[model samples]
Target: MEKGSNHTPKALEKMRQRKWSKATRAKMQGKSHSAETRAKMSASHSGKTLTPEHRENIRKALLGHKISPETRAKIGKAALGHTRRLGMKHTPETIAQISATKLQPENRAKARAKKLGSNNPAWQGGISREPYGWEWDEPLRESIRKYDGYKCRVCGVPQMECDVALNVHHINYAK
Candidate 1:
């Protein structure tokens, strides 16, 4: 295919459907480019920078693309044992520079506004803070502890045998 040539969806689908013989696939398997060729390819694109428009175009092109499970597994396997920046730490000067950028008045205001209740993206209308139930009180907890013989169901240890206080937890929150 020529560089920058248009490949319509139908053409691309046809290419994907076409399967080469096993021998043809095997011929190119486990092959590496020559050192000189690799050097030339690297040098051709060294120190290149993409314009803002080009970056935006690439981002938009990939916005809604989904990777197959096979591809995702391969990526996970490839990254299993790699650490990109092992033991790396910013110097005091670099830390100061970052703090100065974050401490700007506009940046501080934006951060503070984002953390405001209801205004925050994670806000859930304060449902988490609502009381559980009238029955979910200290008396009910003590009754459950007595019913369980003052012992942990999982550990089988009596509350009197341990220094830490024992708690009776509800098995079902909705109840």
Candidate 2:
């Protein structure tokens, strides 16, 4: 018996209370830890550096994991066929609209340049001097009145009933 176990007071205490087994002692010790300590332990383990041999082992494990060329070709063929089927059903105008929306990088750049030029006073000279486009037009007012049924376009309330004059707004000022 251990020195503590041989003592009369300790032996008496052990007799009075049931002694925990080794497995029970281990389980109790495991359950004694606080949640904060467990999180810190998990975080510390996550930062551990793997050995070169371990990395090599992982690489070897994933060596044959890629999709084969034949499988890739099959997937590619299926996708192309699916796209062709979908595209074939679309009307020419629909296709044209879709194609127009997908502007090339160069086209996008030109558009951005044009927009910036129009907005920036420094580049104002680069654009046309004509001030008569969509802005400040009697025709625009007429169109807005027609679209809104002679109602205030700002609040969508009737223009005849409202106190304020209907302000024709180009919803997107970017235009």
Best by lDDT: 1
How do all models score by TM-score? 0.34, 0.21
RMSD of each: 16.1, 23.0
lDDT by residue (tens digit), candidate 2, 3-44:
665658977787656556565567767465689998989988
Instruction: Indicate the worst ten consecutive residues by lDDT in candidate 1.
Output: 166-175
Residue 59 of candidate 1: its Cα lDDT?
100
lDDT of 1 at 88: 89
lDDT tens digits, residue span 1-175, model 1:
7999999999978776665657667876999889999999999999999999999999999999999999999999999979977898999999999999999999999999889999878889876546665557778788888888889887899999999767666344454
Which pairs of residues have clashing backbones in candidate 2?
Answer: none
